[model samples]
Structures are given as C-alpha cells and as structure tokens.
Target: MTIELLAPAAAEAPTRFVERHGRRIAYRETGSGTPLILCLRFRGVLDSWDPAFLDALAAEFRVITFDYSGLGQSGGAASYRAEVMARDAIDLADALGIESFAVGGWSLGGMAAQVVTAMVPERVTHLVLIGTTPPGRVEHPSEAAFLEHALKPVNDLADEEILFFEPASASSRAAAAASNARIAARSADRSPPIAPETYLALLQDRHAEDLFPDAGGYRDFLANCGIPILVIAGDHEIVFPTPNWFALNRVWKSLHLMVLPQMGHGPQHQAPEFVADLIKSFVRTRQRADVAA
Candidate 1:
C-alpha cells in the first residue's frame, strides 16, 4: 500500500470497536503485511500518533493503533495497571482473530508491550520499544514543572511542545510544531482528550519505582523471550533519558539500540522518516531470522 506523503488523518480510516473483557476497545488499522500492533503513550488516544509516521509504517506493514478501554472512544471502566492493559491488548487481538503479530510500543505503551511479550512469548514475533524505560526505579525523572504542565490542559502550542520536545533549541522546537500539526491534521471524529483524573490513575503504576525488582529474573525473561527486539531513544530525553536504554541493555544484550541526538522523549516525532525506515528494516530482519529458526 502506497500511502500519500502526507500523514494519514483519523478521518481517513474509520474507527472500529470490539467487545472484550466487558470493554469496547476502539482501533484503526492501515497498511498491509505482518500485523504490527502499536500501543499509545500516556494520555494518548488513537489519533495522537503522527499521521506521517503511521503512513510510513502503513505503507509497508499492517499497523494497528487503538485506545485503551475506558479512554478515548473505547467504552469501559478506567484502570491504571500495566497488567490489565496488556490483557486488554491480547483480548483485542483475539477478537480480531490475529493469533500472532509484532508489537511496537512508545513510552507507557512500551511498558505494556513488555508485559504482554513476557506473558505470551510464544505469540510475539518481534518487539519494538521506543522512548521507554525498563521496569523498576526510574533513573531519570522529568522536571517537576514539566510534569505539572503535562497533567494540566495544553493552553497553547508552546505548552504542548514542552511535553514532547526540548525548549533549549530552536530547531527542536520547530520539529515539535511540525509534529503537532501532523497530529491535528485530522480533525473529524477525534477521540476525546483523556480526563485529568484518568490520566492521574494511568501514572500510578508507572511511578511505582519498586515494581520490578533488581533480581536477574526480569533480565532473564528479556534474554530468553526468543524474539528480535529494538529499543530506540533520544539522547536528550527528559522523561526517560538515554541512560535508561543503557540500563535495559545491560540485561538484554540482543537488543538493537538507536539513540538520536538533539531529540527528547518523542524521537519518533523529531525524526519520523528515519525512525520509520528503521522500523521497516528491523521488522524485515526479524522476520528473516524467524524463518531461519
């Protein structure tokens, strides 16, 4: 499928919902090939993704993005735990009759992907974790001002940029503006913004520093998961700094890592084309390795 150069709009693909676990999970899929299920970051809805990035992936792979139950267009009770969210992802796949697929998760979504892959390693062929931190303590915490701004409503464009891009540089700020424009290109049928209380609940699990013990067991799982994995981050990431990737690499030696310069928490937005190409090439390599095995 050759997607237009422009980022895909929410209106381009109609939203579909599946009933599972007593929740109506809303999703939208584009492109064709090996199915790649994508989970959104904190407070992100199906429409929050950069249309250009989605179009790039869709051009070569079947990309699926959805809202967690009880958030956005999905109907259900709101929950915060990653375990529950992971189960929701699996149930949605089952509902769609997709037995096996690749998973790409960004930030909080990456956390959920790890849980899903850990629980059902036999079903996941590939894993992509971008701008995410490993389980356990958060080594690099965001500035309190930044965190406060993220929780409050975006009163202006600058506020939104502060959440995703670095403010110290003009070029980075410009990139953020472009990214935001692409995100809002599709105005119709947009998912409602996540509520403040709901967003707070979502952060409860993520902020639990002691959730993953330092024991070698968690590292062992990544090592023996028996799937190709890619971990991408930016050197200047404020939320999960580049060092977090190093922490994850210490345990998971097989991870394919990419660290972008002059980028923040949202490397995908800062370098969409580059990141898109990396995802495509990495997925292909993993598929070949799977066949050989």
Candidate 2:
C-alpha cells in the first residue's frame, strides 16, 4: 500500500547529530505550545514515524521527534542499555533547552519513556506509556512466535510486518512489508546491520534483569513516579500484546487505558486519531492541573 505523504506542513525538518556518546540522534521541531517529545520503538528511525499521525499531533503541540541512537540515519554506539537511551532523551531535551515536556513513545520507545520519568521525575510532567511493560513487578511472557524474531536472524521482515498491525488485511500486510523494505534499503546505506546480540541486549534491558540492583527499584518507579500515564495498547498486538498492558494498568492506577479494537502494536500508526486526541487531552488536563495546584 502506497502511503499518501499527507499535505506538507510548514514545519522544520530535523538536523542530524552525533552525540557525545557517539550515538546518532536526529530531531525536528513542530508547532509551538507545551513540548511533546516523540521517542521511537527499538531499532526504529525518525523517518519511520508516520507523517499523517505527526501532522495531526502538530495541531496542538511543539512536537519533537528523534531517531534513537544506533538506528536509522543515526549511528550505533558501543552501548545499548535502556538507561543510556533514557539519557539520550534527557540529553536531547537539555540540548534543546526544554526544561519540561510531555513525553511518550511507541512500544520500546514507551519503555524508554519510563526510564526518563524515573531519571528525572520533575522534568517530565505528563507521561504517555503506550504498548509497554514496566520492569520487575509483573509481566506476561511473550509467546515463542513473538520471541522467535529476536532469537533468529530474519533479514526479510515480511512475517514480522503482519504481526505488527492488526485486522491484517492484505493492504495492511502489503503496506507494512513495503515499509520494512524501504527501511531496510535506507539502513543498508546509512547504518550497520542489527546484530542479534544488540536485539538481545534491548530485550534484557526491558525484562527481568534489575538494572538498578535494588530489588524494588523499578517497582518503586511505577509506585510513585507521579505523572499522567497514558497506556495505549492494540487489542491485536502480538509482540507486547494486550495482556502486558492490562497488567500495567493494574499496577499504575493513574494510567488511562485506550484499547484499539482492530489495532495491533503500533497504535499511533493504526489509530492515529485515537492517540493524537489522547495526547492533546492529556496536555489539557495537565495544564488544568497546573492551574489548579
């Protein structure tokens, strides 16, 4: 499916950068209001962001989107820890002189958001945790089919694309497959091949391992990491899936759950309006909270 490049918005295109840690980060600015930072899933680039979804979001935010280190036009670093990626978010925010921003990401990006909130609770005012799992407290283990992609090397992502979006119509499958192909071609020219080890590192960072060493460090994060957490999950997500999100909602009661009936892992992609509206609403609520407090 050929994605229509929606009408171009008069927004600034991001500049490319190699940070102090040797990780490449690309960022662009749009709109003007409370800052809304966009973080991508693991191994995704800034361009992979759907333009239509972004255009809708720019309607209300000074949206900032970035390519995570080691992916896309960005170069990979010697490190791939979640904390390090979290630092990248903070560093990007600091570099841009954004003292406070409403932040969120899709899938792995959402997990990275957790790291940022935990790192500096005061800096991130409104948190959006979509298609993610908080570390330690509880998590439904992903099925073998989902885990298979990480364990084995599959350069052709045709099979994986189907698992990403739901209502798996032929058009959706074809469009996703085409999208992956485009990304693969772009990465071939700009970045290194994603080694299995790197993929494993990300999975480990997200799961049972205690990055902070303390038994309840991460749990404490969910317990008191005060922020308006938006937990959006695709009813059809085979990767993180809905169960993982439900478990998250139970633990973090402040979180607002948005379950898209026919959607899968990428809510922003499958149901952009549902997501864009939620972000706008959350920001509004936060603004009210600030005025009230």
Candidate 3:
C-alpha cells in the first residue's frame, strides 16, 4: 500500500498547545485509543514526523507529536539536558489530562524518555526508543565528519539523505525520497523553525558526554523498570548505530528489539508500514497481557 492510502486526511490535524510551567508546549494529536507521546529528534519540528508512520500508528493508537519548549511553536526556554526535556514532556501530558500513556523518543528524545520512565514510572506504561543512544557514554558514536555535515541546516534532498539514510546504498536513498515526500504532504499548519539559539544549544548539548545525572546507573534502572520497552533502529544508522542500543544489555522479559535491513537512522520512515505493524503488534500484545492479568 502507498503512503497516501495509509495516511488519508487525518494526519493533517491542526496544531494545538498546552500551557505548562509558564511555557506553551505545542502538539498535535491523531487517531484514538492508547495515547502514545512521541518526542522529536534534535532540530526537528513537529512537522518533521513521517506522515505515513504517524498515520499508520494513528489507525490503532492516539499518537501525539509535540515541540519542546523554545523550539518550534512552543514557548519558554530551551536546554540540552534530556532530563529537562523529559520534564517538559511530562508537563505537557499533565496539561492534556493524560494520566497514563506510552512514550516514544527518537535520537535526543530517546535519552529523555529513559528518564521519563524512571522519573514517573507509573505515568508511562510503555516505552519506545528509536535510533537513539543511551545517556552518558556512547559506545559507538557516529563518524564525526559525517555528523558535522549532517547537522548543518538541511537545504535540499542531499541534506535529508545525510540526516536520515545511509550514504552508500541505492535502496536507502529511495526510502529517503519516499520519507521526504510524505513529510511534505501537509502544506499548511506547519510548526515554525527551531530558534537559532535553541538549535545551537541542542547541537552543543547533543555533543556533551553526559546529559543524564548518574548516566552510569540508567542501565540498572531500565533493566528493572518493570515497563515494557521496544527498541527499533536501522542496522546502518550513522547517527546512532543499532549496536549502541544492543550494547546497553537491556535484557528483560518485556523488551522488544528490531534491526531493519538496509535502513539507516530513520527506520520508522524507511519502513513505515513494517515498523507500524511491529509497533501495533507490540502494543496490542502488551494490552492483552494487561487484560489477562
């Protein structure tokens, strides 16, 4: 099926905001049932989410994509710390009156989601970490020169290719094209660009060796957090390779790991239909278990 077939018209929902801690957190909610809050990657606006992926997930879940404070249309100060960003996510959910939900964070946001599950363990019932690295020490950091170029403001398809897909593969390049097209489908109600200072802070913060307090202890926390987790990434990810996540040793009865072939940093976009199916199946199985319990 095509992206248009899955996305339909529901993914174009208007932007909304919630006031929290003297800041306005902008967000858009799509679909219904089982709230899943998705945090964006560095320098990403809410408009950057893959439409096909969002629309597919929305069919079975209420997927929410939001901007961090001081980024996109959101108001307030911006910081590089994942813990601070995690608080922003929690606050926005509270403002929305969502008591319990799943949390999905990509890249920088994934580091924050780690704290979110630990900070308010009961609030987030499930977790999804995509193309993300653990806080503190990065065992397999992306190639420095490649990352330096990828961070530059995207001006064309070439930039998108660097940011999301592997550099030397024909299939990966095609997936990048398809992903970009889906994101461009919505021409109106787009979120504003990231502030210059905010983007800079994020860039600097992203490079920091340690963003989470006691990053060393994070692994122990997730190992026993009692919350189900799904870690999805492309095997060829240049930003944060799949092995970085595997190296975490996040062995648990409830954890699910997926490494897609010939894909890069953005597996969700590279294989939206397949990734969406994996997500839906994972969530539904958990829900059924809860019911059975």
Candidate 4:
C-alpha cells in the first residue's frame, strides 16, 4: 500500500486524526523515508512549527508533527507533564504502525522526547533535541523575560523576539519576523492557540518540581542508552541556556552537540534549511555506522 505524503509546507499539510487509547490524536506528515516524529514546545500546536523548516526536512525523511492529547485539535484529557506527553508521541506512532523511527522535540517537547527515548530505547533509532535542556542538573537558568512573554495571552513580534529569538542581534530579529510570517501563512484549518488557563496551570504544576527532573533514572538512561543523539541549540538561548547542554559534554555515549552562533531558542526558525541539512547529515551518518557495525 502506498501512503500519500502531505505537502511539505506546514501551511499546506492537511491535519489527520487517529484513535489511541480512546483519544483522538491530531497529526500531520510529509516526505517519505524513516519516520521522524517531532514533539512541540510549550503552548505549541501543529501550526507553531515554521513552514520552511518542515519543508526542508521533508526532503530527506518522513516528518510527522502532532498535537498533545486534549490540546490543539486533539481530543482527550490534557497533561503537560513530560511522561504524559511522551506517551502521546509513542501512542501516536504505535497507532500509525511505526515500529522504529527517530524522535525530535523542541523545548518542552524536547523533555518529552527524552522521556520517550528512555521508555523505549529499542524502538527509537535516533534522538534530536532542539532548544531544550538536559535531565538532572542544569548549569544556567532561564531568563525572567521568557516566562513573562510566554504566559501572555497574545504575543506580538516584539514579544516573540524576546521569547524565541535574540532581540539583541539585528539578524536574529529579521529571522524572527520571517518565521512569524511563515507561521501566519497557515490561516485556514489552523489549530487553535493553547488557552492561557491551561498553560498557566501547567506553570503552576511545574513549579512544584524541577523542569527536567531526573525521575526514573533519566540521566543514567541517557548516559548509557547508546542511541545516536543530536542536540541543536543557539549560543544564547534565553529559555533553556546552551550552557546546560554543554555542562553534560562527554557524559553521554553518542551525543553530538551543535551550537549556532548569535541565535536564540529557535535556531531552526532562524536557519530552517541549515538546521534541516544538519539533521539529515546527522541521522544518515549514524545510520550508516550502525549498518556497518
């Protein structure tokens, strides 16, 4: 059976749904190769991803993006906790009959990706973490402005610059504008923005524990998992500092880190094609080595 590939552009891909454990999970897919499931950041929906980034990645792999259960277009009980969110990704993959695939996440979604990798390391071929921190201890904390802008009911370009881009750099600011415009291009059949109340409750619950907790031996699992992991980050990430990932250098067996200069949290948005190319190289390179072994 030939599966239809959706348009690579985030604006053009049609949303699809699947039943998983009594919940209807919403997802979108493009390209055709090894399946790649991407988890979203805080308050992110399927539309939050930059179209250019998705388009570029579609050239090399089957890219899948989805909303967490009960959030965005999905239907079920919503939980922002990493474990619950991780299950959503795994369940969606299972529902789609994907046996082995790569997993990528951004910010909050990155945390969930780590959980997913830990839970089923045998099935995950590779792990890509973008603009997010690692488990256990962190070297640097997030900026105060991040939460301030993130919690707002509506975010203008200025707010987005502070939240996702490097407002101090003129080039980064330009990228922010372009990314926002691409995100806005999907005007029809768009997923609704996450409600403020839901996000606010998430924040309240998060305060009770560490952002990236070492629960269930996460750090040890990551350190020994042997999965080819790629971490992409900006030099000056305000939300999750790049230094946090650096703090764990050489700790994981097969971890590769790429820090983009003069960028912020959303490096993929700032350099969509570049990031996609990097990902393609990373995944293919590791897969070749695995086959040779």
Candidate 5:
C-alpha cells in the first residue's frame, strides 16, 4: 500500500487520529523516510512545535508529531509522567504499525523519549534529545523564571522569547519572532492549548524521586545502550542547562552533543535548517558505521 506523504509544512499537514488501548491519539506526519516519532514538551500541544523546525526535519525524515494522550486532540486521561508518556509513544507506534523508528523529544518530551528508549531498546533506532536533562541528578537546575512563564495559560511573544530563546541576545530574540510567525501560520486545525491548572498539576507531581527513582539504572542503560544518541542544546539554555549533559560526557560512547551559541532552550527553533542538517548527518553517519560493523 502506497501512502501519500504530506508536504513538509506545519500548515499543510492534516491532523489525524488513531485508536490505541481504547484511546485516540492525535498526530500529524510529513515527508517519507525512517519514521521519527517526536514527543511534546511540557505544556506543549501538537501546535506548539515550530513549523520551520518540523518542515526542515521532514525534508529528510518521515517526521511524526503528536499530542500526548489526554492532551490536545487526544482522548484519554491526562498524565505528564515520563514513564506513562513513554507508553503513549510506544502505543502510537504500535497503532501505526511502525516496528522500529527514531525517537526525538524536547524538554519534558525528552524525558519521555529516554524512558521509551529504555523500555524498548531494540525497537528504538536513534534517540534525539533537545533542551532536556538526563535522568538522575541535574548538575545545573532550571531557572525559577521558567515556571513563571511556562505555567501561564497563554504565552505571548515575550514569554516565548524568555522560555525558549535567549532574550539577552538580539539575534536569538529575532529568531524567536521568526519561529513564532512560522508556528502561527498553522491557524486551522490546531490543537487546543493546555490549561494552566493541568500544567500546575504536572509541576506538583514532578517530585524528585518520582521523576528519577533509579538514576543509576538509567545512567547505566544510557552508557551501554548501543543506539546512537544525539543531544542538542543552546549554550545559554536556562531550562535544563547544557552543562548537565556535559557532566556526563564520557559516560556514553554513542552520545553526541551539539551546543548552539547564543541560543537558549530551543536551539532547533533558533536554527531549524542547521539543526535538521546536523540530525540528518548524525543519523546517516551512525547508521553507516553500524552497517560497516
């Protein structure tokens, strides 16, 4: 069966739903290649993804972006726990008949992607984490201001700039505006925003132990997991500082890290095409190395 691939643009891709585990998962896909399932960040719905970033990724990958179960257009009980969210991602893949694929996530979504990789290492071909912290202890924690803006029901351009980009850098601020405009292009069929109360509940539930009960186990898995892992961050990231990943530099043999200068949490948004090219190169190079082995 030949499936038509949608154009690699946020405004062009149509929102679709699939039933899995008695719940409907909302998703959109573009391009055609190895399936890349992307999880959403904290307080982010399907519409929250930057259009430029998604379009750039779709150029090389069959990028699949989706709202978590119970969030946005999905139908289910809402829960932001990483482990539960990991199950949601796996279920989506199963429903789509995708046996193996690359998994990518940003911020909170990155946490879920890690859990997914750990849960089914054999099925995950690659792991891409953006602006997220690794499991266990964080060397440099997020700034308190992040919660102030992130928990808000509606984030204006200023809030977005503070949350994702480095307001201190004029170029970063300009990039944020451009990214916002691209995201706003998708005016129709957009998923609803997450409520403030729901996001608050997420923060409350994120106890230290609950977030990472067995940091040692997860670190060990990441160290030994043969799957190629890519970590992208901004040098000025306030939310999940880049130093946290640097702290684990020698721990993982297959781990690759890229830090964008003068940017913040959302490096992909600041330099969508460049980030996409890096990902394509990373995946291609690693896959070729594996085949050679």
Candidate 6:
C-alpha cells in the first residue's frame, strides 16, 4: 500500500529575526497550547519537517521550529559556534514571546538543545534529546567506520540509504523517499547548500572551546533540572551509541530512555508516532508535576 504523505499543512506565518550576533534566524509555529520548539538536525531547515509528525504534535502543543544561523533561510557565516547557536534558540524564544517551554532536538540540533536548556534552565520546562551526544566522545565512531560508511560528501550520498530513516519494507522505503523528495523539491533553493568554505570555517574556528558543554556538565544539569526529560534514540542509531544516553539517564533525577527498533538517526521521521506519543506522555507528566507542586 502506498502511503500518501500530505503536504506541509497549514501553518502560521514564519518570522525572521536577527539574533544579537546579527545573524538572521528564521522560525515558525503552529497550534496553540504549551510552547514546544522542535529543533532540527544538522543540514536541515523548517521545510524539511515531516508533515505527519507536525500534524500530531501541533494539535496538542504550540509547535515551534526554526532555521539555525548559517543554515536554511537563516543567513550568517557558515561558522557559528554552538554557543552562538544556543543563543539563537533563546533569542528565538524571546522573539516568539515564549518564556518557558519544552525543548526537543535531533543530531546537531540535539546538542544545541542541551546548550539551550543549560543556558536557560529556568525557561526550559522539560527536555528531550534524540540521536546526539556530548562533545569529544569517549567512544566516538571509528575513523575507519566513518570513512567506510559515514563521511562521504553530500553529493556522494545519493545511493546510500539514509541512516536516519531506514525503510523497513519496499513500500515504506518508497513512502519515505517520496516524502524527502517532495521536501527537497520544494526547498531546492531555500535549503542551505553545502559550502566548502563555510563548513571549513566552522571546522577551523573552534574558539568557543566550551561551545559543546561536556558530558559531566550535561549530567549535572539534567540531574538538577526541575523538569522531566524524555531521551529517545534509535536502537540502530550509529551516530551516538545508546550507552551515551544511558550515561545521561544515570545522572538525571527524572529521565527515561526509549530505544525504538527499525530506527536510526532521525526518530521524528522514522518513528513519528513514537516521537509524538513520547511528547504527549511527557507533557502529561509535566502537567501532573505542576499540579503536585
């Protein structure tokens, strides 16, 4: 059976703002309830969202998403530090009049989410991290493995199966490809093209030595956080091993982990129902906590 992926669906007008650093950050939102910002993965934009995923969450909470500095429609040097990226997220929240809210992110965006939550612990009501890890991994993927399968240039990835969303069946694969192709087609120009210079600059400019907060700090922050957390990752996730998240949960007072099968780098895409359900469950837990408090 062919799964028909609906369009982007009706959404509120997207807003653009220049972060304090003068980098323009573009964001958009939908629905109306608790503020919920959906931070995206590396090399992604607002248009890359999975419509079905958006539809489910947008119905329950005020959904937020943005293009980060140096990517998508946000114009800046391709070299913004994670601190700057985290600040952009906080600034974006301020722009949207969101004082406190739940935060969720994937991959690089997931790392940024940690920074955002730590930077403004008071403003973040709950936290969700997916397919990410703290900086300078103690168990980083092998260089040989990266060379053999992961680090190829973007243009060279056409035939490689998307590690993020592994299509379990031919039908599912077709559906997933169609969805990505549609988004790719629509944002052909808007999606940030890989800039060798920009990518290199970000790689070279590492002055923000503390840009990615260390795992020790991540543990402390989550342990002391007054909110609940839902840490979701793919069972087959190769980006950051499950043990990393296990280490994080060990530090948290109230954090749970969900490892989904038939998934990888992007749970929001490959397991949208699971992701959406997790959000709903977390929101309910937060509400209960508030009532108890």
**Highest TM-score among the candidates is held by which one?**
4
- What TM value does model 6 have? 0.80
lDDT values, one for every candidate: 0.77, 0.64, 0.78, 0.89, 0.86, 0.65
Candidate 4 clashes between residue pairs 3 or more apart in a chain or in different chains: none
Better of 1 and 6 by TM-score: 1
Error of 6 at 103 (Å): 1.2
lDDT of 4 by residue, 1-293 (tens): 99974555667889999998999999999888889999999999999999899889999889999999989999998888889999999999999999999999999999999999999888999999999988877768889999888889999999989888889999999999999999998878889998999988876776644678787788877876778889999988999999887757777767899999989989999999999999999999885123211
Compose the digit string of candidate 2's lDDT tens values, residues 184-234.
Answer: 443322434456777778666555443223243655665545577777877
> What local lDDT score does residue 62 receive in model 5, on the 0 to 100 scale?
88
RMSD of each: 3.8, 6.0, 4.7, 2.7, 2.8, 5.9
Candidates by TM-score, descending order? 4, 5, 3, 1, 6, 2
Where does model 1 exceed 4 Å of error?
A: 1-11, 205-207, 211-218, 287-293
Candidate 3 ranges beyond 4 A from true positions: 1-11, 195-197, 205-207, 211-216, 250-253, 287-293
Model 2 global lDDT (CA atoms, 0 to 1): 0.64
| Candidate 1 global lDDT | 0.77
Leading candidate by lDDT? 4
TM-score of each: 0.89, 0.76, 0.89, 0.95, 0.94, 0.80
The alpha-carbon lDDT assigned to residue 137 of candidate 3 equals: 61
For model 5, the run of ten residues with the poorest summed lDDT: 284-293
Better of 2 and 4 by TM-score: 4
Clashes of each: 1, 1, 0, 0, 0, 0
- Our model 6 lands, by Cα RMSD against the true structure, at 5.9
